[model samples]
Target: MTDDSGADLAWETLYGETAYMCPGFDIQREQVRLPDGTETDFDYLSESASVVVLPFTADGEVVVIEEWRQAVKRVNRGLPAGGVEGEDVDLEATAVRELEEETGYTTDSVEHLTTVEPANGISDAVFHYFVARDCEPAGEQSLDFNESIRVETTTLDALREGIRDGDVRDGRTAMGVLYYDAFA
Candidate 1:
């Protein structure tokens, strides 16, 4: 069957404001008009790019971090992830930098797993996943002024158990684990 989805649809942004402007995602509010002549105001968070990495050691343990997130108000275990600064910075480089900064682990080899949108409902952010191998302790974590992370290393089985028991609650971490299990 031929798709005529666009024939009856119309969308227009009436007004918008950048709620949170930063180097990463920028949150904004926009007023839109639908096809049926209904108008609504919507909030959107947009980002240029982001990265997540599954850092693995020679013994097969994955390096993770226990960090307190303000949004969730609890410490959660997650893989290394962050946003890129600009087009000059490659995705793998961003993954490596985030891994080192968050977990103090450095990897010489990294393979791309996938790119995904963790939250599409209210945000336009793309998460690029990578599997990093031959990882070793680098140094002290270079976190932001507001970040407090404790690095941890665990086997894949333990991670799986954490997921099964509803302990690993971070979406990016879960996605990285699933991708590593399937591909890495």
Candidate 2:
């Protein structure tokens, strides 16, 4: 047996430090020695692992959220997602918690679909996508102070149409829906 999985091409990180810090993420800069015998510095966003849940109601509708995204200067339509918090036990728990907290929807079953590095070149953002089934309204949405969210329910086909029509522009949601559609 042989292990030739590009391990030899890996760069050696000589030093790494936080260039900037914020509430959700931080900018990390690192000095590394490349496999080509060259040294350089690189910077990237360091974010916590997160989960994106595509929740489905028992009646076959999908749970979605419309939230104000300050960076994009618009209310973006997306699925329930959030960073893994300190108290979250694991990725599946975080997905369930985020689905309920962001959209007031509770699910009896959750299946992990896939994990992806959404922006590997610029950041180490690991997104765990899950399919949550039999979701029903639990209570009022419990959102963060900085969040302004509105919940909606629609058929899975309609959500897929939204993805095709460019109405669902959030990358995480789009990716989750498309991935589930193609493989799940």
Candidate 3:
């Protein structure tokens, strides 16, 4: 069947079930019929949208963070980011909240940069990127219990260097920085 965009390769979902449930996401398995009439089970991770904030301080320095990432078993240097909680009013609000929560930085000029599905093949994770300018230290970091974050300041050039030298391994951070630099 042709999709809204006139694509002939759209697969029709026959049925869906939760293969596993977790705190932030769920493993969803669905029986789908391909365009050519073949049926198979497709699995993917489903989660709420998230936000990434590339905040710049009043001094024009970028607000960065160093956090211990359990999945990779190392400290990751990246921008302030988090999943959109129930209390978040919107994407920009989530971005602002996450920046302040992870780095104690607050900004009045928060703008949406872009949105991307970082891992489309395996997960349905939508990340909204925002650029927060004139960020100031409003209070001490109020990180989540599972978060171990250390706040710092840096320049965009230094961040670009980190991205080039393979020091910045977080895809969301890299995408935000590169997207802002290239477009905004």
Candidate 4:
């Protein structure tokens, strides 16, 4: 099918089933008709949108967190990030809260940088990116029982080296830093 823009509408969902779901995310199984009129099965994940903050100090140091990531079975060095919980506030507020919660830093200025589809093909996870300037020590990190995060800083040079050396393995973290560089 073609719309007003003459863009060929490609896939048509025949059916979908919620295979599994938890509090934060869900998995689905689906069958769809391809543009070529062939049918196939597909799977995808759904989750609440998330936010990542590239926080920097007044002197140009990027604020980061070293934390144990159970998914990776090791500690990860990455920017502060969290899910947009509830519907009470905006993505900017979510960034601010996550920064403080995971890093204990507050910023006087925060601005939207970009939006990222972390996993475009298989996950409905949109990651909003922001840059916070002139951040300073606010208070101790307020972490959940399962969280263990430590706030740290590094110059962009060192950060690049870390990423090159595989010390920074979080894709979002590396991507956020590169976006910060372009948008800085």
TM per candidate comes to: 0.87, 0.95, 0.95, 0.89
Off by more than 4 A, model 2: 1-3
The digit string of per-residue lDDT tens for model 1 on 37-104 reads: 89998898888777888889988888988989888899999888877776635777788888899888
Ranking by TM-score: 2, 3, 4, 1
Question: Residue pairs in steric clash, candidate 2?
Answer: none
Candidate 4 Cα lDDT to native: 0.87
Across residues 19-76, which tens digit of lDDT does each residue of candidate 3 receive?
Answer: 9998889999999999899999999999988999999988899999999988999999
Winner on TM-score (2 vs 4): 2
For all candidates, the clash counts are 0, 0, 0, 0
lDDT (0 to 1) per candidate: 0.85, 0.91, 0.91, 0.87
Expressed as tens digits, the lDDT of each residue in 1-184 for candidate 2 is 5559977789899999999999889999999999898999999999998999999999988998999999989999889999987787778888989998999999879999999999999999999999999999989889998889999998878878888998889999889988998999
Write model 4 residue lDDT over 1-184, tens digit each, in one string: 4377634556889999999988779998899998788999989998888899988899999999998988879999998988888773777888888899999899868899899898989998999999999999899989987788888998887887788899899999899887776666
Question: Would you give me the overall lDDT of model 2?
Answer: 0.91
Question: Which of the predicted structures, 3 or 4, would earn the higher TM-score when compared with the native?
Answer: 3
